[model samples]
Target chain A: MRSYRTSTVVALGLGLALLGTSAFAEAAKDITLLTWLGGPDRKVLDTLVTGFQAKHPDYKVKINVVTSQGDARGGMRTALMGGEKPDLVTNTWPAFRKELADAGILRDVTPVWTSKGWDKSLAKTWRDISTTGGSVYGIPYIFGYRSGIWYVPADLQKIGLQAFPTSYDDFLATFDPLRKAGFAEPIAMPAKVYAHSEWFETLLMRTGGPGLVTDLGAHKIAWTDPKVAEALRQYARLFGAKCCGDSKLMYATHWDDAADRIFVERKANFLQIGMWINARAISQYHLKPGTDYSLGKFPALGRGFDNASIIDAKEILATGIGSNPDGADAFLDYVLSADGANIIAKAGFTTPSSSVDASIYDPVAAASVRFVNEGDVRFVLGDLLPGSLVDEYRLALQQFIGNPTEANIAPTLERIEAAAARAY
Target chain B: MSAVDTRLPPPGARAAHRGSPGPAPGRRAWMPESATALLLLTPVILLFGLSVIYPVIETLRISFWEIRGLGRPRFVGFDNYLRLFSDPVFLGTLWTTLIFTVGVTIVAVTIGWTIALLCAFAPRQTSIFRLMIFATFGISEAVAGYIWIGIFRPGDAGLLNGMLSAIGLADLAQPWLGGANSALIALIITAAWSAVGLPLLLSFASVQAIPRSILEAAYMDGAKPLAMMWHIMVPLSLPGARVAIFLTLLSSLRAFDIVFVLTAGGPARATETVGFFMYRESMTQFNLGYGAAATIILLIGVLLVSTPAIAQRTKGAK
Candidate 1:
């Protein structure tokens, strides 16, 4: 009996030792991600995190979501202010990144980029866009072409256009024919908020190219510059073509309603928006890409920057306040890995990392990839603009849509310029 | 003890101090009336301080600093207030708020009082109708805004436009929320619809309080129904209607959800109220200091509207 008790005590000691070791191992730091992303975006982040956790079993990713009604940046700022010390944050707005950087909330990841040899996966241009004040703070993982126009192929056939228009004038010329084909509006302008500004932004890209976006965003070039005026004049030409319906109808429409007009009601022909609409088209409407709907590049304006495009990209930034910088850096490296990019592509998104398997993209997403690869790309102008100026700019554009005339353009530009001056 | 001696002490007597075993264990000993009152009010006062007073004080403090996004704040004093007054957008919202508040109060109170008087004549028959009207008050303002969106939608698919077309008035059928004037009118109509319930219930209660003797006397005097309604019921029910006007006016001045969902202060901001302006500045732009200044102005406006009503209500109260 004494021998048996002694043996049992030894066994219990071994078991307790094993449990204590495991408890120590499980105490490894968790990499918390603070984001305002929801729906499909949350699903994508969750997938990437699962892949990351699988590769690094010692680390776990905890995603903290900041919910808001509109303009999620407010909620994000609120979360940070409420003492959420997340290791990583997903940012889309360049201005917001600057704000965070200025506040010293972000860590300069320039050294990590070189130490990890990220240059092999991401191009120099991505690095350039991710930098502010000559220091890199984030890694842009996913991008969407903002310069593409969404169209239903069958509807184009009705207007006697065998394919989407390839030139500015040709695109405008098709409007009359589409209207003649029993459509009330040729192009649905969602002027209720900011989508109405999309056409003008693309026109600006065509007229003044990427340099203008950079200069205007920095307030280096005034809003009254001839280059900016020329862009607005080109936008006015859409009104001249009678491309959209009455100003009243345009003012009443939002992006979703315009999408409905294009897909559900079949009352309108085209909409220019970001790539989320592709997901919406496939998932919400249950439509096939390239067959039911397709995307075309904004028609060429015969400008020097005709080959250039605009895109919206989401980047992951490291925070200084995090407890686990090593884990956060490892996660960032994993995000740009071949496995990570492929996972993103398979989820119906385009990744900036060239390590992605190109075959994973659907035809429409493939087209967006092709168009973006064709030339230099800039972040969408709205995302580049300061928060204070963005609203006034959108409101001015909204007012312009109310009366899209040459007379209105000057006042509109002047109004935005005044706001910009104060904004800077 | 004798019955007279054992009788309860007169009100405010120090009964507990007389011979109360120094009050039971774990219970309070004798205290002055004011001390007892203070003890009773302590929790409520603390709660009020935390939820209401603290926020107001913090907001006032924030108004003095210029906080832009995550950037460090700078003390700007009253520059933000100065900027708001000079701002065309803020000034425009003030004008719009006045118009919306007055418009909603008149429309809701007038319709509600009329219906209440009409229902009072046939209380049993109109019970379901009264319930149906009051049901709208239970509906959330945001939900009501969404329902109105379908009605005021731009196209022929919209309910109002379809009804107009069905009635051979297609020429008059236009996008109800597209134009500045029309959008504001639609918002007012929706708000009034949501607000009409309270006035109806209040006025009905007032009308019910009319003595049956007085009504019967009027009836015996051969006074017509219209004469009784105009001379007696209308004059007597003014108190309830006045209260309704005051309430609806305050609610309308602070309208945001309906505006946000339906119009978003759009078509050149013709429908923006001071409340929406505050939200846009604070939440959207992260102009905390500027937004806080706007909030303070709105608080003052509310106080101005409420102080008179509160004074009149408490005129003879202890």
Candidate 2:
């Protein structure tokens, strides 16, 4: 009887200890995230979130997907000012990060960065883009390759071009043969606000090399530089030569249609866009990459000039405004870790942040890796300016492209300068 | 004494009694009644004050301020207003809105009046056609905008463009929404199409109420078809016509969805109306103060233009 009683007491004690641990585990932290996840992307995000939850069962997250366009960030700003903000927000444009920082709504995550070793894992370019005032505010979630020329295999074959050109003179020469063959337009250029901005970036990169744009974005260069004027003049020359489509059509036609004309209809030989352009072409036209089409960097300017590409990093930021601030930081840490980077790289995205191995990504994404590491890519322009100034510059570029004349250029540039000065 | 007074009360005594008054009622005496009426109307008054009057007042107040999104609204009195006046886009939008309003009003009212006249004189089975015609008014403006977009899509894949190409009129299949000059006109056509149904229904109701005997008498007195329409049907339908015009004018002035969805005030802001401008300023630009100021200006312009017409129509009705 003594032996039985002793055994029962031991079992009960063990049971009580397990119960205490289980209860402690059940006391999970909760977080709220606001994002713009819709359609197929929502499923991918859901999978990622579920994976996150499974790994950290002690933390619970609730996501609120807000459906909006252009006004989503503005609405969040209003909420931040009103003292009601989400713990995390996705799809934040770089221009507004300054405003949020200025407003003191964002949390300085430099400690989180150091603790998680992200400072060592992330690429310097990615770190540079996501940092403000020597403190990290966000993690680079997605990297988009923006500087490249798109062409059809058939058009290249017809023009006797063996491969895509890598120099400005050669690039212009390729277009001359196409124009001489009586192709109405060798390229499809849109005068829409966003489209015009892309063209301006392309011109800036092609003429002065991408370093000037990077310098301008970093506030190391002035807008009134002679190189800037030369770039504008080069764009005007192309506009005058009828190498591009009607400017009016630019206002109505979307970028997809422009891609369609280049890829499907074979109307245009070249299109300047980002990596997503290639993805859109593949999905829209069902064209196999490396066979039907391929990618190339924006041609080099001259000797000793580096072939510079444009890089835009999508960031995940932990905004301080809800329950479980620690949980938000934990989730961000998880995303910036090597494991999360592997998941993203497997999904056909470039993960240059040294956390993820390049061998894990598909060939297309691996190409982006090469572009960033081998090609020495730089961040896009207009990212350093305030949101209002960026909008004004976009509008000014749209106007200038539509009415490409020497008369309109000075006034447009002057207006942009005034807006930029006010911005600072 | 009572019987003699009752039997022999003279005009002089009655006049003196009637003329004698204890007090005189002046305009000030109407105050209490007016106050009671205002009090009774307080809910509606408050509603107008909140939704309409307050916004106008706030807009006028903010017009003098330099307010960005969710920031401290700073007073820069008249600077914004001055900038707006000097803005070419704003001026262009004003002109476009005016032209669009007038163009849509004329087309919508004319077609509606014609349809209503036909429906009034048609056979019994024509009620189905009338119903079908009037059914379009049930659709929301955004839906109507999208539907017309499918029809007027600039490419050959569009419904109208495909039809024209199939019928061997391919040469005429130019970009309908792609041109600056034709974009506003196309939007005007869409606005007319969406709005004509309401006026048609109103005019049909008024036309049916006209006395049939008067029409028969006119026919018997050797009235031709043209004369019968101009003299009999038109004159009787004038009241309905006036209401229809007023409604269409108001609708045209406030039209936003069609222009927004179809053109987005684009192709170089050629199709921008005051309503679209106000929305872009308020929502896209996040310049709520400036947007408010623009809204007030638009409201004042609309009221000034429409007040005389509304008063004239109301007086005519009386």
Q: Give lDDT tens digits, candidate 1, residues B148-253.
A: 9889876776889889999999998887777889889998999999899989988898899888888889999999989999989999988888888888888988
Q: Which residue runs of candidate 2 sit more than 4 Å off their true CA positions? A: A1-28, A40-42, A179-183, A209-211, A214-222, A303-306, A342-366, A375-384, A402-412, A419-424, B1-64, B123-136, B149-155, B158-172, B305-318
Taking every candidate in turn, the Cα RMSD to the unseen true structure, in Å, is 4.6, 9.2
> Candidate 1 has what TM-score?
0.92
RMSD of candidate 2 to the true fold?
9.2
Predicted structure with the largest lDDT when compared to the true one: 1
lDDT (tens digit, per residue) of candidate 2 on B1-318: 465544654334443457842124221233444576688899998998999888677678877787676566788877777777887878898899999999998988899888888777783767888788777778887888889877875445467878999999997876577677878888998898888888888888888889889989998999987888888888899779888888888888887888887777877678989898887777666676677677777887878778988799779789
Residue A187, candidate 2: C-alpha displacement in angstroms: 1.4
True contacts kept of each: 0.59, 0.24
User: Using Cα atoms with residue i matched to residue i, what is each candidate's TM-score against the true structure?
Assistant: 0.92, 0.82
The prediction achieving the highest DockQ against the true structure is 1
Question: Which window of ten consecutive residues has the lowest lDDT sum in model 2 chain B?
Answer: B21-30
